[model samples]
Target: MAETHFGEWIAAHYATLWPELFDPALIGATVGFLAGLAPGGGSALEFGVGTGRIAIPLQDQGLEVYGMELSPAMAAHLDGTGVEVLVGDYATAHMTRTFDIVYLLRNTITNLVTQDEQVRAFENAAAHLRPGGCFVVENYIPRLRDRVFAETPEHLGVEEYDLATQIAVSRHRWIIDGEQREFSSPHRYVWPAELDLMARIAGLRLRERWSDWHRAPFTAASTDHVSVWAKPFSHSRAVPNS
Candidate 1:
């Protein structure tokens, strides 16, 4: 089956499940501001911009935002928003425009399911960046493995509520595949070290790594990953303006 299933599932239930589960407004605005803080007004690109969840707010932040997504259903939802949404895979997708910032949010990077593909995704992101441009990625840390193996449930109590639907959704993470890895859901997990190595291979330099959008210090119990990388100006010739 195409990876489109995941996008379709989210699009079908976005209005119902999204707001109740997470604060989309807060997330989108926060990421946008963070990205905008980069040089050059944060002219940005996003890989896997599912349903414009973050892209829309990024635009509201006055940054020129472009996106590449793997799902047609999700792309269609972005119609008329004036946001550039291209339907394609991030690993092999190519764009002529290099931006000051490129981002992969919502743990979308882990969907690649393999190390080689994940590394390729980083390479692709690097290819689309201007010299001195930044690439940001946000994901949950791998602590889910320990939490799942422990007898106690790492309770992710409800963060919000929907009075109309009454479908209370709680979030949690767990370990699977022999405790070598953990996942927030069914996809594979990647460690921060692994991502750093991938960035190095892509000719990008690590700028910062944080536990949250607010730049919290990463810890054993931290449940999120936020990493930033920069491409040197010498690599500017590697990309073309689209």
Candidate 2:
């Protein structure tokens, strides 16, 4: 797989192309609210924290949140929010602190071109988690076929419109590996099962899976998004010889 052609250009135009890009904070708040329901009520680490879309709000919700992002431009956007934003690639970056919950949301995992890199990302997350901590991930399940030419048209409201920008955002499906698939925006796709396998290989166990932030049941009709929660290795201390 080739590297994405537009990195710097995308970083520059991210805010303009996706006017609702900042809306992930709402999604993050929802996540924090749900995670708070769990025992221990832990802190969070957001991988690929673009422009504090999620991290800032998660922090505002009173969860101790830190961010690891690759783009300096995105990190700079989080300035003065008091959230710790580290500029580095999530695949290779290391953090001294571990969190009760680590998350990689917004279909950011697809940014990795190959399965190997994606698995490595899981390992990194596991390493950053304390024993019994959870790793939460939200991603779209790739369609088995491409529907890019299916011609199902949809429109956005005027608030989402940018006339001077000349940027028309539309949903389309494309065929990959003989599967009919839909991409809401331009992005690489991966199978949810494949992600689960990657998590297993990284010594993490899947505790729960959902179709959406609302915890909808996953089914065939669901192709939009999936949220997975994985736990680190169990911490059963060995007793010293009496």
CA lDDT, candidate 2, residue 86: 77
lDDT of each: 0.69, 0.64
Clashing pairs in 1: none
lDDT of 1 at 150: 24
lDDT of 2: 0.64
Q: Candidate 1's error at 173, in angstroms?
A: 14
Give the per-residue lDDT of model 2 (tens digit) for 1-242: 32332256456656554444456664665555446634445578888887766677667666788888877767777788888887777876899998888888767887775567788888889888887777887876554343332332232221112234322233544343355543343344566777777777777777777777676788887765545545545643321212
**Against the true structure, what is each candidate's TM-score?**
0.76, 0.72
Q: How much lDDT does candidate 1 score?
A: 0.69
Best by lDDT: 1
Each model's backbone clash number: 0, 11
**At residue 241, what lDDT does model 1 achieve?**
20
The clash tally of candidate 2 reads: 11
The residue-by-residue lDDT of candidate 1 on 1-242, one tens digit each, is 11544556556655444353258756755665465556445678889887777777777777888899888877888898978987899888898788888899877886776677888999999889888888899876654324332232322322222334322222343333223222233345677887888888888888787787777788876787788888877743233222
Over 4 Å off, model 2: 1-16, 20-29, 32-34, 37-41, 144-188, 233-242
